[model samples]
Target: MASNGLLRECVQQLKSSKHDYEKVLGGSVEVVWQSVSSAIERHLRLKKGVGVPGLGKFSFIRDFQPLTPVFLLNDRFISSYGVSWKRPPPSLVIPIAELNMSVLGSEAGLPKDQVAQTLDAVCAFVGGRLQKGSASGRIPVGNVGFFQCEGKNLQFVFDPSFVKSLVQSSNDAKPNVKPAADPIKPTVQPNSVANRTSIAMTDAIGSISQLSLSRLVNEEPDSSSDKSSDQKNDKRDHHRHHKHKHRHSKSTPHLPLSTQSDTQTSTSTQSQQILPRFLMLDPLRAPPRHLTSDSKYARVQDSAYERETEDVKNRVARSAHEVEEIARRTKAAQLRYLQTKAEKSVLEREMNAFLHGQMEFKRNAKQQEDARRSSAMEYDAVKILPRDPIVTAAQRREVKLKLRRRLNDQVALKDDLAKQKRAVDQAESAYFLSKLQLHAAHEQEERAERQRIEREALVAGWTQQLAVRAQHEQLHPTRKHR
Candidate 1:
């Protein structure tokens, strides 16, 4: 009854039935009471649907009664129109259990045993003021919701006049504002972009083909072949001459020292460019497999082969990191598993100890309960007498709290008093932090007004300790109670 749907429905019902609500709620007490009785009865008999207009549809189910002639359950099927919903039962609809349990958990620090006890206590506490959840009333645990008992529950009543007023208000509100007349615009026109890009790509492909055709027409194949033949004949003549001249020695005979130096510089420049590219390409592809060492034109290939080597190294590092993260996840999971196992073992041991403790508790409780039960049975068999004793015994505890308004006398008198046997105790504001001082002051005040209460509470404890001390004295005068 204190759920979102129920409270909202109750509010809407009250607002709709506002005119008749006062009359119905303020009628004779007898009439109102009779209406409640009749509503419960009518609710019990209903088999078909009955509308509560703004609230919901309700019906009843018949069941056998053990203690009475019949039992009728108040069943309401309230169709709540929203974006989406299912018709809920009253008990299922209420958030009372969750709200109270959550409240208990926060208040009591979520202890296991007393958590349920706190929840039950909180619910019982709420049950007292729930019927009072009217528009303006409040309750002890009002964080759950406000409770006001003044208004009627107008659950079954609905007025048709309110709906008409709502329609009329909607009609009257139309002419105050006008709708916008402009059309929304898009930034990029897809058709125009597609048409322009298609024409540009076609023109680029035609231009590439035309440029290639023009280069082929401008190039002369016969002249390139004649030049290649002449260079090969010149290379053969030079090699033959070098072979004849260098036959007498291991080193080739140089035409001049300057010519040898110029040849060495050209070879070194080519080697310098080729070695770095080889170092880069080796990691990406085993370049020796796909490339021939004799190919003198290897440097003319694409630069991506070199970049691929670095890319592969990056991929390897990334993969190593991923593998390490996976291993870390595995380690964390195993640690959690071992921790859970240890906790489970401890819980099992604690559970056994708790069961043993409960047995001892139950045994003591059983003996106490048996004594009370036997006393109750005996009292039922005869009349019991009440006693109020004439004697009043009290032990007085006198605690004097001394406050020195003047500290000057002590320091001044100390000049001569230090020559005496002993000096007065020295104290400072450090004494203000003593919990014992606060406790003593509190105990003194409590002891003054509630001496009888304190005596009643501590008499058994005092008697037990005192008897032990007396026995200790009897054994040895010099012995202290340990």
Candidate 2:
């Protein structure tokens, strides 16, 4: 399979010139990559052909069973970069000693000990493989290429194409262009199906010939042995003939004349019998009838055989043509499927990108809306509240002090009112008490005066009664005594 290194290189180049690419395509980095890759796959897989700007046209070649991709150099590209086989420096030939010194220098700006250690590691890896018989391992270095073991020796295989561009600019040492008159040596042809097929055919023919020679050698001994056995049987038959005849004559002596005559005829016929032989047994005699002459019938048979052979060949050719046609159609369909797949992938990527953008936009819009609502709520709250004059810290402090003083004054006034109310209640209670005391005293004095008056009246009455009683005493003395 051809490496995709060229494609990667092209992509890198496109990336380097992305400013112009984006401007022209009106897309971002990812979009450009998707579009370019999609287009390449479509043309190369389905159409079976695609062209690159600074490279060449690429296509699929169906020379044998499985198809392969190939790049047909454009005339411009060919002129700019002529092809030639390239050979990379051998692994064991690394001039690390020289490189290490320069690398260790301060101008290289690399850690000397670390670089030395890395060099030691590389050399060890290479030397170790060499000791282990063919030095077979990979020596990879990113996209640059790698050293690998090919056979007894190590070789490096470059990425993308194995061929190097020989073409150089006219300004670059004038290119040392030579005229066409100079004889050019042709390079070795690559191993391909044609060469393999020819080699296989030669090997088959050689094997067939060897098999035929062995068969002939093996059959020669069998034929000679059979001939010697036949000769021995003939000799044994000659010796037994006379003895068998005598015995047969003794046994059949009483036979009838008709039976005897029939027996005689049978014996004669048996005596005349000869052994069968191969056609080529007597080379001196004329060949078999078929080989000796050709008849009309033979001619007809030959023509029929020829016709059969021709018919077989035609059938084989037709079958092959049909197979080729079917393969062609299948390849075309495969290409179409590839194109459709690429287009679908590109569209899906675009759709995903678009959806992501939409989601991001919606999220941003929601955030903005939330922020606006918050701001509006704050504004509304401010509008509903009463606004006070703005004051500095000192002014606010002074206002607070004034407010405290006013509160203190109001509290004092309330305390005075409460005290006055308590004093008025106490005075009312004292006056009520005093009034009740005075009334009690006055009543007591009045009662005493009444008692005295009653007593005086009683005494006066007693006096008056006493004077009257004295006048009557003389007269009542006698009665009182009585």
Candidate 3:
């Protein structure tokens, strides 16, 4: 089930209880559920498991086969079989109603309502801590494990010691029962007595079959030779019967020797070809003694060993391929990085050149502006100076016209310089804005590139870990026996 469904159930339960949680939890049932769910999600993103005093521990377990996260009830929860202390398989569904809140509250010396309120308070506290920690970018690690957030998702890596402790606890909780013996040996032991026995049996069977076939092929039709062969076969049969009787007597001392011999004779008379003694014994009634040390058994062992060896080889080859792929990607990333760096350098140089040119243009404009101001001051002084008494009216009028024309030219030049200055100011502002935008874009690209690199590195690390685990399993395969 999804977490939302679980939260909905909690909300329904709270509403059915008809408690005024608004005062204690500061919300109605739906709001409280939302707050609790949000708190749980945030906490789980930062820790392995979140525990409630009167409720079960909530955890997310990554299934080995699927490698997908499964919601789990880690404590104070029972499986479908109603076994409370057993370590159940990871599951999505949980029986929330099975929790004995009253008993738990009594054990804690608090009322049920208070216990519920306490749970709410805990959720609030965790939410507050997470918000504070996220703002500071320094989330504290939990005892079992911690989470690393990547964008909107969280990646969890469990501690080895914590996993070991969980394993130990599960083992301790299991009932002590002796393991049953395997009917067939799953592993091969080349130097074992069972292997030697199987080898000898195979050789004997081959030799016996070859001798029987050769005798049938090379038979003579002469009456004297036939009689002689019959006599020899009779003697051989008697000797085999005696040997079988002796062995059975030694194996089954409870049975009388006479009865064993009579049964062996009856079996011998019924079959033309004598089967192996192991074939006569019922597999279900007796332990397989020689049956387990036969050619078929040896073949099974050999095939299992071959398969295991092949699997190991395949894993090693896969690991090598992954490493090569990672290396190739790393090289490609380095090339891209170098190219980006070169482009960035070129852009910086161009920007610097543009800014330098703008500064020079502004400096030349200023110098022209100063020269214009100085010429205006000189014209003002000329206008203010006293006139000569001997000068004629026509000369004075011509001089006045010349002065007015010069002043008009100076005013127009000053207006043009002001317009040029305003245009330069606008250009400078645009250039700075573009530069800021380019810088922001570059930073965003770099961040994206960094996140990609980190993701690749994490994948490579996981691949390496899998390879190491495969190698470790190959080296210590006997651990599985334990």
Candidate 4:
């Protein structure tokens, strides 16, 4: 119960610190609690104790009583001594968060958020690894302990050598100082039981001897007459006997009935005074009895019954509250699920429309590319002729008809060359157009590839989310109606 209280306190501290932690660790309180609890479990399993700088240590102690030789002698003896082989409950020391955030931040050599992220990552890794290895029995972790899984729970068994080493180290650290001397009196062997008993006996004997000598000195002188002497002796003996018996009764008030009766009879019968002697004797006494009123017992019983009833009522109330909380959360989760489903559908529709537009654009680009190629082919098929020099005139003057024919020939050649130049320009324009179309197609392909990648990423993210939701539901299943 104390451990549970401490764990709850620890969880609360971690939850409060989440605001100052990284976004990666800014999950629900339950997630943080689970992560922390798992981390603590793993730490205890790996090392007997885990020390987190600025956050105190979480230590595990095994609770068991070793069996002695006497207990091992027989089953009856073992049972009589209450020796048990059943596993003892674990003892855990949960750390309290007392150090300031600044101290942790400084120790980590990073900002608070980054430190939180690092710690979270470490916890997740360790916890996940341990959980995965849980099926294997007694996996050794360093030299401290072996981690074992009992059904679903993890357990740690400390190594005897490690424990011994720790104990030895602690003992070596302590100062060795001689004990102080006794103040009253010095004895040869002060620590020995025999010496103490002998010293007590000697002191008691000396006191008795002193009392006897004092009594002898205080006695009145004996009478000269035989009758008077006898009477004085008898009176003195009687006085001494009564005094001794009174002192004995006072010293042992709770003597048994039989012992008391025997002592009384013996005192009445004895006429001679017995000298006081020191004798070690165990007193025969009964244990004290207690008497309680019936009404008081009845009241106590009533109070216990009332307490039990109240506890039951509180448990029922808590159970009802938990059920209500679970139901509310489930409903909220369902609503969110519906909202996400709607969003996913809308995204899918948008993606499909975008892909259709891209396909249409690619088709137009292909058509333009084809048209440019056709024009280029046509230009390649055309032939261009070199321009001819104008015919030189003869030395003598020529006839008018002959000069007209030569001018006409020159004009025709010029016309043919101009047409050829026009054709060449058209071919060059077509070449440029084809190159532009090719570039546009390459851009469209790149854009399509990027969109495909984006779509895949979106789908993968949705799949991961769904998987997580399913796993969560599996872990904390709700009651199903028939």
Could you tell me the TM-score of candidate 1? 0.19
TM-score of each: 0.19, 0.26, 0.22, 0.20
Residue range 125-194, candidate 2, lDDT tens digits = 3444343444445544233234453323444443443112111211244567455431332111236443
Q: Pick the candidate with the highest TM-score.
A: 2
Q: Which regions of candidate 3 are displaced past 4 Å?
A: 1-57, 60-100, 128-161, 167-255, 261-482
**Local distance difference test, per candidate?**
0.40, 0.47, 0.50, 0.48
Better of 1 and 2 by TM-score: 2
Write model 4 residue lDDT over 161-186, tens digit each, in one string.
75666555545655784676454333
lDDT of 2: 0.47
Cα lDDT tens digits, model 3, 66-149, are: 222223332222211112222334233222222344654555555667657756553333334333343111121333343333
Residue pair clashes in candidate 2: 46-335
lDDT of predicted model 1: 0.40
Error of 3 at 94 (Å): 11
Model 1 bad stretches (over 4 Å): 1-314, 317-321, 324-342, 345-482
TM-score of 4: 0.20
Tens-place lDDT digits, model 1, residues 1-482: 22233333333443455576323322222222223233333432322223321222333222211111111112221111111112222211111111233333344344333444422332232232233333223221111112232232212221234234433544565676556423332122235543345344444434323322122222233565567568768978888646554557756464344346434544543543322444322222433433443333244332343454354445545544554565568668966876786677567546755765687699889999888877844656576689976543331211111224245566668766775523233333446557678989999988886987777779978999999988978989665545
Q: List runs of model 4 lying over 4 Å from the truth.
A: 1-117, 128-159, 169-482
For model 3, the local distance difference test gives 0.50
Which ten residues in a row are the worst by lDDT in model 2?
89-98
Q: Residue 248, candidate 1: how far off, in angstroms?
A: 71
